[model samples]
Target: MDHNINTKTEEETITSTSIHQESKLLGSNKSSYKQILAIGGGKGGVGKTLVTANFAITLARAGAKVTLVDLDLGGANLHTCLGVEMSSRTLSDVFSSDIENIEDLCAPTIVPNLQLISGAHDSLNAANLPHAQKQKLIQRLQQLKSDYVILDLGAGTSFNTLDFFIAADVGILVVLPEPTSIENAYRFIKSAFYRKLKNIEHQLDARELVDKIVEKKEELGIKTPADLLSAIENESSDLGGKVRLAMNEMNLKLVVNQTRTGTDAEIGFGVKNVCKKYFGINVDYLGNLEYDSAVWQSVRRRKPLAVEFPTNPLVATMQKMVGHIVAEQAEKIKNEKSYE
Candidate 1:
């Protein structure tokens, strides 16, 4: 569960075994791994599902095999957004041992090249599982054979939500222009930062320092992760360097949703700069999605917005965000190859 790409020693074995088995399943070499795109927000009704459904459709249309997962363990409605009925075997099947593997629960959506993995019902206690079950699920997710796996995470910074978000190759934090949403978004990032620091390279001393900083936020007037980092560096520069490297390795992206005015559109950039200055973390502002009535109309009809209104402005924004992600992933793969 190390936050940076190096992962934990145990995780290295998991990856090697996963690639070996899954690559044989797909009859392909382990030359590339599937891209995982996850969308999470601090609160509900912030368009996390909407963005996820359309984003998956866009990538699938580009001929990439994609799977949209409803990781909203408490409340799973991604099926509703995709206009697909519930599968006979949902995540509950896996939780109940009715299904041996999560991939067995895969069901097709209306869109070609895309599949859906329905969420587990809260009644099944899928949201808060024993540690063994959670680890098994995480490993299974790594072996999913798809070009992309889009996870629509539930709201808030719950441990389950935060772990899935952290596991994603491209984790997106969505927020609205409203004050409540913005505040929650900031909280979400802060919680994620602490969680990440707590796990990175198993540095307990640095993690303890982070805990103290967070606990003293009110008294010390620390508003950003960067401010907290400065305090740690003042205590010990060596620990601060490790923290900096860990934070820099994380690629937490942001998107402002349901924006109406020009001011609303610019809010993402503002938040990005603030995070950079105070958090000492670089946030990629993938741009904002403007408010469009057609979005609701499509959701009402239970069709993806991209399918219903391909020419909508919001769709264009989704396209641009996808393009950025593809480019970023390509660059990342290229660098990995160069190092190899």
Candidate 2:
């Protein structure tokens, strides 16, 4: 990958020479194109967007063509993080007017091999984009050509967000160690599971079982998946089987961010335990990121944490998590290809 080029400027030399050397040294390998990863959080202010942007840049720096899409329609700060000013054309223009191709709105970022598609800037339109338009946007994303497409999703359990999260090849939920964030994260996982079950309700007694679970939420105190499964099994075996299949096929991962101590690191373990004991969901605790001042400083400078502090502890943690996710996904793709 390292091809010496004639460059004079210091920036050009660093970008061309150093990055190529690093990519080669890291043994970065390419895979068949078309991978989508969505970074989401149930609660805001957990560094979801920041991590998304940096991780995209990191992948790009490793010689993969990456597209970092800002899907946080109401609050689009991804462009700012990438040091790109508001472009004339955005997803808003595509949705509201005569735009033939969604790729027309893609704007190049400062980082080579990385591009961004800004979301609608108009608060009213962004917040109220019809379901059809949202579906169209996702379809466009699916057609994008790149090794990886990382989506920075908005905080909430709205249908739009949940749909995007489920659509991703890998759905990473970023959470802090606080009690409220943990509670919200659990709720988000449960909601996503229920949503997935609803989508496949045509299979046997899935619909009825799900309805019973929802109707008796107060009666069953269904705070965990185990409780929900027990209730489902008691109510209907067919529905329970469907739910079990969905849970087994789930591709969800968790990342505990802003870790301050050993206790904070234990959050991921606790979540995994709760998920296994209660929901029958075996969530992979991908990794934990340490609290770093450099993260906040990079935000102030409108730069990604990975870019600003490439060797920082948090960046190392994120890179390790990304590696695990990528390897697992690559294995799945290879198996699929073999079956084909």
Candidate 3:
């Protein structure tokens, strides 16, 4: 009897150790995936959500586990855009109730390897979510398990939008070729940069100078980012040094939409030149989408452009964009692993 008891105890101990070792291995694997991208623009009606949805779908179709989050709390129509109706739960439901785990709110979409975390649709409270709540939402988003997490942010330079954009691995700013959209896109980029500076305000004097530039632009219509940077440089050499470093570290991408001519296609290049010349920022030109009836048709059908019109020109543009984005992310991951 004593011999049998000893054998059983030894077997149980070995099993427990093996289970612990397996758990550690699984945890380590989970830690490897942390890429996130946020799509936003300063102006409205620039097809931000549509681009995000289609990009998420394309990535998922390519065997990636993608999560498309509708962060446009003011008008959360991403579910409608994706042709998904009556989600049993949403982000609001998770935040406002006892459901603390975000996975409970994740709704499976029609696409395999793709999931949708619908925003707070038609909810007044969602539009007015406090900064703390927005921060909490971002923290939860980081914990999500996926190869790519794309956030479709609301328009304008609201703190909510900037916070989400800054949290992302890639900040994609979408704009049309129209003058109004281009102007607003620049303002959005400046606001986003200042917001980032504020977050690291304690580490450098650049934050103070950037904030001053933002204030002057708002109050006096400085109009040119280069002029503002020059003024700051003249004020203090230390501030200028920090500003250059901040610009060097910026990871912002530009995407031009609704191109009608070669001139329209060159809008992205112009924007890139402006950012580099004035703000000393490097903006990646991720390509453009031509004006197509299929885009509007897909919207009317309540499906993503890529899904409804996979062979359209717009879809091709998006496919190329997604390929570049994926390659960039893979390179980043490889570099990180090499360093480790």
Q: Highest TM-score among the candidates is held by which one?
A: 1
The residue-by-residue lDDT of candidate 2 on 1-340, one tens digit each, is: 1121221223233333433433343343433346789888799999898779867866676556788888888987899878889888877876778877767888888888899998777665676667788788888887776778898988888887887887787888999999999998888887887777676676554776677677989888887667777778778776677777666565778888889999999989999888889778778898788888898898999888766666566766766666666667656655665686
lDDT of 3 by residue, 120-224 (tens): 885777867788888888888888887678899988998888888888888898999999998899888888777775765556645666677667776655566
The TM-scores of all predictions, comma-separated, are: 0.84, 0.83, 0.81
Clashing pairs in 2: 225-278, 225-279, 226-278, 226-279
Off by over 4 Å in 1: 1-32, 122-124, 201-223, 231-239
Q: Which stretches of candidate 2 lie over 4 Å from their true place?
A: 1-33, 203-205, 209-224, 230-242, 248-250
Candidate number with greatest lDDT: 1
Which residue pairs does candidate 1 place in steric collision? Answer: none
- Provide the lDDT at 169 for model 2: 78
Question: In model 3, where do residues sit more than 4 Å from their true spots?
Answer: 1-32, 203-250
TM-score of candidate 3 against the unseen true structure:
0.81
lDDT-wise, the better of 1 and 3 is 1
Residue 130, candidate 2: C-alpha displacement in angstroms: 2.7
Q: Tell me how far the alpha carbon of residue 227 in candidate 2 is from the true structure, in angstroms, after superposition.
A: 4.0
